[model samples]
Target: MISYEWRGHFENPEVNALHAEGFDHAPLADDWWGQVTRHSLGWVTARRDDTLIGFVNVAWDGAIHAFVLDTLVTTAERSRGVGRHLVATAVDAARAAGCEWLHVDFDDHLEPFYFDNCGFQPTNAGLIALGTSAPRHV
Candidate 1:
């Protein structure tokens, strides 16, 4: 069984490592990730005993809108409703914080997961490429 919490303590390395496995982002120094999670409106984590398994962050503009960022669930834990639970927790937190809108941006591959599983409605969105896909190799 997995448990969720609105936690304040987020240790890097553990988190960066979990994120690397979950999100496929190259893991490096976690100083930046620590700073961001520390300042987020809310952060949710999933744990089984002492192991860090999943995480997500909620960012608000100090108004009626809140965005869900970095929704991650380890590959081993995927397709087991863990992602949906994380999103639901964030949504409830946002509403409790007086937010009227819960916004999320995800890839097309996740459309069914977020929309069908998590109950998010379809909407037109945009994306931009900010850097080269294949940086010059050495």
Candidate 2:
């Protein structure tokens, strides 16, 4: 059985491994504990038998707006509702904290998962690549 928790205690390596597996990248030892503690409104963790299987970070603008970042589930755990549960748990936590807006940005391929499955509506949004050349006026 998978158990979900908001702001749950986690060790960096387990989360790092899960993230690496989910995102299909080599694991980097990121300071997840410090990052979440310092910047997140909260985070949700999904565990099965005490092993970290999923995670999602909720970052807020210190008030009404919350952004969902780095939603991840182990590759072995995907397609089984673990990712959905993680995001759902994060959404509830944000709403309970009085956040009025929840935002998420994802690649084009993930639209169905974010929209059809998770109930996110389409919205006009903008992004600029950091450390890259700025856009030139026509």
Candidate 3:
């Protein structure tokens, strides 16, 4: 059985592994715990038994707007409504916290999941990639 938690306890390595698998990349030593606790409105975790199978970070503008980031589900757990549940949990938590708007950005392939499944409306947005390399100090 799968269980979900909001602001739940999680280890960096487990989340890192899940992310690597989901995003198809190598695991980096990301400080997920520290980052979320410090910068996010909250986060959701999906687990099967004791294994971390999914995660999503809810970041906010420190007031009325929240953004979804790093939504991930383990490859084996995909297409099982786990991702939708995670976003639903996030939506409820953000609403309870008094956030007026929740935003998410995703690739074209995720339009149906975000719009149809999660009920997010389409919106005009912009982005500017600052190059792959780390930014240099002025």
Candidate 4:
């Protein structure tokens, strides 16, 4: 069975490994741990027995909005419902935290999967990218 854990601790090695695997690109500054803890409420990981298969981070503005960020399942683990489970769990957490809505900015190429598999739909009014005048956040 697959197990999920909401972590109070940051797994730096796992974060670095995922980054090296091309699933992440954020620069890990020296204060990375502090920054992550300050901005994020928790991280969740999917494990099959002793191996870590996937992970995601959850961020909330505390009062109003919540965003799902940096969710990744290793390529080898794709299509096995791990992604779905992770997303469902995130949705539950968002609802429990009193968020009015949950949002994630995803790859345009994966629209079909997000819609068909995860039940997300494109809104009439889409997203905006204010390039480089602000720090490029993913």
Off by over 4 Å in 4: 8-10, 22-33, 124-138
**Residue 104, candidate 1: alpha-carbon lDDT:** 92
In the range 12-40, model 1's lDDT, one tens digit per residue, is 88778877887677986677356665566
TM-score of model 1 (CA atoms): 0.85
Q: TM-score for all predictions? A: 0.85, 0.93, 0.94, 0.76
Write down the lDDT of every candidate, Cα atoms only: 0.81, 0.91, 0.95, 0.70
Indicate the residue-level lDDT of 21 in model 2.
Answer: 85
RMSD value for candidate 3: 2.7
Query: Model 4: clashing residue pairs?
Result: none
RMSD of each: 4.2, 1.9, 2.7, 4.3
- For residues 46-135, what per-residue lDDT tens digits would candidate 2 score against the true structure? 999899989999999999999999999887788998888888888899999999999999989889889988888999999876555877
Question: Of models 1 and 2, which has the larger TM-score?
Answer: 2
Highest lDDT: give the candidate number: 3
**Where is model 2 more than 4 Å wrong at Cα?**
132-138
Q: Tens-digit lDDT track for model 3 on 88-116?
A: 99999999999999999998999999999
lDDT order, best first, reads 3, 2, 1, 4
Answer with 3 or 4, whichever has the higher TM-score: 3
Scored against the true structure, residue 37 in model 3 reaches a CA lDDT of: 99
